[model samples]
Target: MKGFVKNYSGIIWLLTGIALGSIAGLIFGKKVEVLKPIGDIFLNLLFTAVIPLVFFAISSAIANIKPSDKLSRMMGFTAIVFLATVLISAILTIVAVKIFPIHEALGNAQLSEKIEDSPFAEQLTKLFTTTEFYELLSRKSMLAMIIFSIMIGFAALKAGKAADQFVGFLHSGNEVFKGVFILIMKAGPIGLGAYFAYQVGVFGPQLFGTYAKSLGLYYGFGAFYFVVMFSVYAFVAGGIKGIRRYWKNNLIPSATAVGTCSSIAVIPSNLDAAKKMGIPEYIANVTIPLGATLHKDGSSISSIVKMAVVFALFGKGFDTADAIVLALGMTVLVSVVEGGIPNGGYVGELLFISAYGLPIEALPPAMIIGTLVDPMATLLNATGDTVASMVVTRFTEGRQWIDKAI
Candidate 1:
């Protein structure tokens, strides 16, 4: 018992805090919201540190790879696996919504502010590139920052001996940021507890009728995917043995993701889990951080739910052939570009409204759903990266990769 407690002390404290906060929320109601600032502080600290963390971690991974072929192969397998998993998630959501139908009347909510829908080309341009260097410092330009980091990494790799010091600096910076992440996480118990208090206390009663129905479907589907689909991915990656290994090491990251509700914030835990699962350092380093930015299975699922709900609100059918095709495509794109931050679905929600030519009034409901489901969505998005690393390892290192890792 002592050994078990020692091993899981952090998780224990976190869960304890969450449990206490939830009870307080239930008993005290809206008054519990006063604790929300602690949670906000925690999230703010993470967002502030994440940009540099991503830059240093990704660039350092690229710079340290001596063989270009190895890097290329890993990247290739990573892309294939990411696409496969995200598409599977989107497809599963579509099928679920179709079988059980989730759309209901969300009532008429007026839009106070006009939405200036940008052109698709301009949106894509902004997604990948920023005019000013300082803009990349913001979380909104996460994809652009990732792209810039990759370019810098390649430049350093090609620069050969002259870039040795630069590469070392990158490594040092990566270590420093990682240390920063650890320091921030030390406050997870109180921070996440306070956040959960506000969520349950302030927003608890708002879930009713259609909103409750949508959440049930989303939460149900999310649970099924998290358990069944993740298990399937694990088995395929390493058979029965893989399944055992994955679940054993996944709990920490899973809980952390649920508590934090941010994929980028969960990267450290996922990377640590990947290591314990015997994933190669190179694969874990590249895939986990990059996956946080580029891959979002959970968001893909939410995108479909949001679309179906919007379609239903407008008294339109979501099951039309064109709607399904367009929704799946947009979900894939949205998953790639969405920030790994909390409530990152805002941009994707706007895009969804614009793509379907829906009224700006449609945005608020979807955003509400996004917020309500963000924790579970983030759980799948963040933890999926670890299993994805295993899948990538399976492909790149061959079928016997798990045995070799052991």
Candidate 2:
């Protein structure tokens, strides 16, 4: 029963979130604005943990690799898999946006009136220059922090005895973060429930239909992308047999991620599933957990797709160089650096929008569409972590290690 519960907990949470969201939506239909603060609090909680969580996890993972050469190979493989997944997901999202263009214009006369009255443009400029600077300073931007931490961690690894001590400290710190993360995850359902309720209450039934086409496109592409990627991963990992057990075991984590829309919360289940795959405990501990911080295939893909949609909506074309940079930068920024915090989806998108000086008014529409697509993005993310765990385990501990463990 305990094992069964663990395996299906994600599904449970997802259903709970949906049910609660519906109830909240109905009850608070006219008071959605009041519930916005609750959503904001949840988002803040998720974001607050991201920087430290990522720094320690990645540093510790890198520090634990035995042979330096093996670490290099693992990093290389991780990079390739991460990049490939992001690119593929982005392409699928872009295609989907093009095929199913959401052209429904805003009919709210008051919306333009409100926009004109608001000082949002001035605030946005301030946010772009000042707030963004602070974000960079505090390592709020995942990409910058990731680059800094990786360089620092690598340097520490090479610093002989001093580095060893520091790395050990980071490993210990990573454990502390893990403990905090666990506590937060245990509270996830309630927090998510509140958020969903707020969303439903605020948007009402009418808004759902308004955003339906865009949302549908996002979800449709997300699903298709996940299916294709999962198939490829299974094939590469040695056919159905190697991946069969994993597929069966992925239910809880995948469901949890989908329901919560929070990848970080599913780390424990991901680690458990990786262990069940005959991945060595040492490898699983490092890779599965670390992957949670950096392996955001879904988020990266979704961001690209969202960006393309935004561009299309505005009748703009992506500059080739800019697109490449944005795609790669966002992949690293949001995944390897930011860590998989809840509401990270919003933060990452915001970072991209602000970094490139994109219009702020476009965000609301993009978010509405993106949320619908998010579940698939999260599913792909969890699947990527599972596949990455196998790849890293095989490379680090060797094929013989996996065979022997099995």
Candidate 3:
């Protein structure tokens, strides 16, 4: 009974924080403007941990696996799952926009003028062709960080006994970053409360429903994607019962991700659940953490859906070729690049808006609607990670390679 109460307390606190924040925002939204700073602080804390965490975690995980044959296989499997997920998401976004257009009734406000002032196009161009060091320390780019970490890790592994001290240092750094992540996440209720209040104060409850419908459509499509993909994993690896069991064990982690709207905060629980479900520890360690950092089916999908909404609102009819290309490219690139960054959805959406030279006035509306849609996006991301893991596990056939000390 005591344990049950303790477990329930976390959920209660999360709900209470959300409620209080919303109420506060509704009452003093325009005057106080307190939520943005608090949210920013929260984001800062998250970003501080991202770089070191990615560097250490990826280095350590890759260093432990041997023979290098399985490495190629794992990379291939991950790439396929990542691309497939993005494609499905793009198709869903296109269909949703066609069927239940969001921007149909919005007021006509010229957005091109606003788009010209923003830095999104420039940022996108920079991302396509930047040196590793420039991207890592200067731009703080996620793709750059992953590439640098992987290269160093591979080097460390190849160095034999000489790299032992350096590998130990990375492992220690990973531990420290993980500890910091926990400390920050414990304050989640407060952050959620403050942000929610600000949102309600600024937008009111009526806007909630409108945003919710768009979010609902995205999640509905995401659910379809998850089911279909998991069915394939089941057919390939285990049967229906195995898949069902996997889902049963994963429910807690999934629900936590949905409620918190944070895959980073849910990582420990996800790792634990993966192990309990009989996923090999090596696979779980390598894939789950890597997936959390790289696989973002939800954010990629939501970016496209939101872009469609923006177009509809502006009365700009979709260009079939551009829309298809944007949806597919944005989903994959954003999923891969933005996955490691904190506030990934926020950053990804801003980048998307800027990249396409969308109007700035639309940003406020996008921010409001985007925040509302985030939890669903987080849910999709968490589910995508699970599906990716299952696929990788199957592809690898649960084979265990001996870990060699560098």
Candidate 4:
């Protein structure tokens, strides 16, 4: 139907592009590698734009904050719950990948750099702060830029009325760069399609196996998290009665999220589910919307899986303690910023590449994984908001609030 196409137009176009490219790769084999330059141009544009885009988007979101006592309390609880759940998801995926390692399905792409030896203190300094401002302009300095941006936002907040104009400028810049990314994403289908063609041509059919294995890993764990973890959260929120009410009312929201492949789109369904589940209006109102932007358990899981696949392909061991810690930290950051802009999935991809110091050639595969995993990710991201609202209610209103609301 027309409505269906309208809703999924972006996905349709991308899939179509990938399909066409795959056919070309199949037919021409290595000859299709000629199309890689087009993909490189697209990746280069993204790399060039992402640093400023991150600076403005994060800074503006923080700078525009309007403080209120109730809002602060709610936000404090919400941040705790959101970050905790996302971390839990990341940790679970790490455990799973260790048990059954992600196979190198994308052929042996020599895209990763060997992590340089450095003292722990030195590495920490570089991760959080750059020596010069110009260094923040590079994607490799992503975490440092994030730290700097947050500092600026908080400083602007501390300035009060005097910084109002500056806050507005940050907002304007965010919008401008957002528009710039949109313009770039208009070429996504062609670029990604060509990229896929080259990958399939060079890597051959094994590419499909890697994609399938990673997807299966994510979906299997995503389902477990959705079913088991949510039940536990609901029980913690309201006991046995809470679990019943949550599942009874959460189906529509889950369906809407999976169907739309968008957390923002499922807001209405989530609100309705929250109301039906006996979440306080204030809690649901704040948590659902904020969670759409901030909480992303599914993305955390998928990002870990993507990193595992990339590590396997690059002949690196992912089980190192330092690597796991860094992946968890990066996963949390990626989840927070995942929905910060249009075509924001690419932002997460770039973040992973930069944080891990992988070459830009690693981006296309990461992007492909993100696209394929989006619907399930949206399912967890959107529905988790509703469950998180329940947890917030338990903390703010006590255990018996659920009984009282019903």
lDDT of 1 by residue, 29-103 (tens): 999879988877876675677678768867887788766575898999999999999999999998998787766
lDDT of each: 0.78, 0.60, 0.63, 0.85
Question: Which runs of model 1 end up more than 4 angstroms from their true locations?
Answer: 1-69, 104-207, 340-342
- lDDT per residue for candidate 4 within 202-320, as digits (tens), equals 77867777888888888998899999998998888888998998999999998888777788999999999999888888889889988999998888988999898877666555777
Q: Candidate 3, after superposition: displacement of residue 71 in Å?
A: 7.8
Off by over 4 Å in 3: 1-15, 34-36, 68-82, 103-124, 128-135, 138-140, 203-206, 226-406
lDDT of 2 by residue, 135-187 (tens): 64442245555555677778777786767778889889888876765666555
What is residue 316's positional error in candidate 3, in angstroms?
12
**Clash count (model 3, backbone only):** 7
Please count the clashing residue pairs in each candidate, in the order shown: 0, 2, 7, 0
Give per-residue CA lDDT, model 3, range 201-253, as digits (tens): 75565545556667777777778766675566544545565466567777888
RMSD (CA, Å), candidate 2 to true, equals 7.4
Assess candidate 3 and give its lDDT.
Answer: 0.63
